[model samples]
Target: MPESLEKHGVSVLVLDADGTPIATVQDALDLLVSASYEGAELVAVPAGRFDDSFYDLSSGLAGEVLQKLANYRLRLAVFGDISRHLRASKALPDLVRELNRGRDVWFVTDLDELDARLSG
Candidate 1:
């Protein structure tokens, strides 16, 4: 079952344990549909739900998925430790920093941080 949080007219759906890895735009679409069905404006996901390629800037999967989510006007928060990937790539940290600056997407370290963000 999906966990949820509601405050300030925003509802967030926290992806359940064993969330499926996002491999394509369709995967992101599916999550959007699911979030809509749950009446959630934001979807809180764990970083592990994304494929390795999603972290590889050359693959373009990250941009595509995030764009799809943004096009739908749904906020996405990816919570977890992505430090290894950050350490491996030169561009990822900057990408993450930029993404976090926008209201449409965020990368957080834990649920409490995500909660604080969503609450705001």
Candidate 2:
């Protein structure tokens, strides 16, 4: 996806929903680099961009991807409905809750929700 910049209360790099899926840690790193190159404070990725393994906590893809972003001090906003994944995993809901409480990562239902969070 062509990285697009959106300036709300914060500078955000928004990825298109129809773009290529992020299937590996390398993909996440590439995205992180893109955000950094664009001098964005946050990167908003469509939830659908992530592979299914990302939502399956047992696969450890989420942890790896998140840790990489954290290591670089890059904030990420995953926007889209991930309710199906949340419902399937007993641990995911709590994990999302905790992440939402922090500044590093946020799981939002839409850009509007992400906008609200950034505005706050």
Worst 10 residues of 2 by lDDT: 1-10
lDDT of 1 by residue, 1-120 (tens): 678778557798998648678888789888888998998988888889888888889899999988888888889888999999999899999999998888888999988997787678
For each candidate in turn, the TM-score is 0.92, 0.93
User: lDDT values of the candidates?
Assistant: 0.86, 0.89
Tell me the lDDT of candidate 1.
0.86
Residue 59 Cα positional deviation in candidate 1, in Å, after optimal superposition:
0.5
Residues 11-30 of candidate 2 have per-residue lDDT tens digits of: 78999988878999999999
Off by over 4 Å in 1: none
Task: List clashing residue pairs in candidate 2.
Answer: none
Top TM-score hit: 2
After the best TM-score superposition of candidate 2, give how far the Cα of residue 39 lies from its true spot, in angstroms.
0.9
